[model samples]
Target: MVRLRWYRAAPPPDLPVRQVHGFLFAPDGRAFLRVDGARHGLPGGKRELEDADPAATLRRETWEEVTLEIGAPRYLGYQLVVDGGTHRYAQVRMVALITRIHPVAPDLDNGRTYRRLLVDPRRVGDLLGWGRRGSRQAAAARQRAVVEFALPTLDLPPDGEV
Candidate 1:
């Protein structure tokens, strides 16, 4: 079984960051989700050598995967994915408010295209993978996002329609 534990603290600088994920919220407070096969999850991917930083990886991944441009990302937390009796990967989860969205291009990594969905916060739980503990942690992260990022910046709309 795989377990994902969420944390509010930044990851230790020593651990090489493998991937960066985001809980991207629309202006109306919905989340930007990506559909792949039968599973859906937040938009993000592994860091590339050209990526200047975690934020850059997220921006590039978001555009490639969903065609959305996000503003400065607010650090949410990290998820430690543990498989079997060993640790698999650690992902840094950031929250960003959507600033612009366009017709999605084909995913560079997979070559196939992806469908982007603006999921209501309440329904997001149903879309995540079961590899994580469950929807409870994702739901809690959404609630924390509302309190830490979304609600405080409610009046600011980005360049495009959310």
Candidate 2:
């Protein structure tokens, strides 16, 4: 069995008090990710709890960005990090059951056009390296955490004790 560790840290005074994220997976074993050209990070956006349920938030973000309707998500867990005395991070994980993917009408809400790419979990190390080289620190760490904690739990090869 794989054991996951959840960490937490206090937040900075200025930033919005709460944050969350989702990890959507496709039936083909590819994981759903967003390419945020504006922030140069993975695709995702802020959520105000009142605006949508956590699962809905994940679906909405995925659809708006990638034009795909992700299936019901299975909540994995969360991580909290305090950094630079300015940002507070809460990274949440969810398994997205991707039923289909295709282009749709342009959405003004999403600042940029995002393309969905199916990624092999085993190649995550290479993805992380690319993110790091691109200076996408948050994206790199998030991908690393997924490889470290999530992928292993799924029973893919190149295993390591979690």
Lowest lDDT block of 10, candidate 2: 153-162
Q: For each predicted model, how many residue pairs clash, with residues at least 3 apart or on different chains?
A: 0, 3
After the best TM-score superposition of candidate 1, give how far the Cα of residue 39 lies from its true spot, in angstroms: 1.2
Best by lDDT: 1
Give Cα distance to truth, residue 90, candidate 2, Å: 2.1
Q: Which portions of model 2 show Cα errors greater than 4 Å?
A: 1-17, 36-42, 86-89, 104-107, 129-162
- To one decimal, what is the Cα RMSD in angstroms of model 2 from the true structure? 9.1
Query: CA shift at 68, candidate 1, in angstroms?
Result: 1.0
Q: Evaluated with TM-score, which candidate comes out highest?
A: 1
Report each candidate's C-alpha RMSD, comma-separated, in the order given.
4.4, 9.1
Against the correct fold, how does model 1 do in TM-score? 0.80
Clashes counted in candidate 2 amount to 3
